[model samples]
Target: MITLDFDGFKSEIETPSEDLRIYNFWATWCAPCIHEMPYFESVVKDTKGTNLVFVSLDDDRRPERVKAFVEKKGFSSPIWLLSEKEQKDWKQKLKEDWSGAIPATLFVTAAGKRHFHTGQISEEKLKELIETYK
Candidate 1:
């Protein structure tokens, strides 16, 4: 898994691209986040021309926990750990109306349109969103 500070995260999300990118913000300790992961993974496996990034909000000091969790889950998508301790400002930068919630998702389409969802998304909804954006 790669670790990124706020600036790096910003650059990643801001850079122009032609493929749809799905960024899922989560943590090892978030139950809802964990619950929604399998659906995300399933979508990642089944979807084409779409990129999914699992962005860990776990503490940077204890990335080992996140790493271990990922290893146990056998996640195939790229995982990222946020290095910033405070998310107040950066969370807003990610999405203005974001409430800093777990299981949040930010979708950026090939055409550069962006959509942000603040809660757990059902598997069907995930697929629908991908189809809508892709």
Candidate 2:
């Protein structure tokens, strides 16, 4: 797992890649985020050639909790702690329509196509989106 500041996150999102990348913004305290995590895990298990990045929005002071939660959940996908404090400052940089909502997802394709979702996503929806990009 990696910890990234706003600039690093921006660079990652801007960079192009051949594989489909799914960036899921979540926090341990968020009920909706927790509720939808299993769907994400299932997607990770089912998807063959995609990158699943769990971008954690937990408090910067509680890194251990985030690490523990990831470990406890047994999520093999690479996890990232979003270290930026000023969410308002960087939210627009990520996506103009992003409202800084938990359980938000950003899908980036090899061809640079970007899709943003701002709520809990179903497994079927995730698969559909992956199919569109893959």
Q: How far is candidate 2 from the true structure (C-alpha RMSD, Å)?
A: 1.4
Off by over 4 Å in 1: none
**Residue 71, model 2, lDDT:** 89
Q: Could you give me the TM-score of model 2 versus the true structure?
A: 0.91
lDDT of 2 by residue, 1-134 (tens): 78788988889987978788889999989998888887787886778878888899888768899999988988887888888575668788888877787889998888878888899888788888888878
- Reference-based lDDT, residue 31, model 1: 95
Model 2 segments more than 4 A misplaced: none
Q: What overall lDDT, based on C-alpha atoms, would model 1 receive against the true structure?
A: 0.89
Instruction: Name the weakest run of 10 consecutive residues (lDDT summed) in model 2.
Output: 82-91
Q: Quote each prediction's TM-score.
A: 0.94, 0.91
lDDT of 1 by residue, 1-134 (tens): 98898899889888988789999999998999999998898886788888889999988898889989999998888999998675767888777777788889999998778999989999999999999889
Residue 123 deviation, candidate 1, in Å?
Answer: 0.3
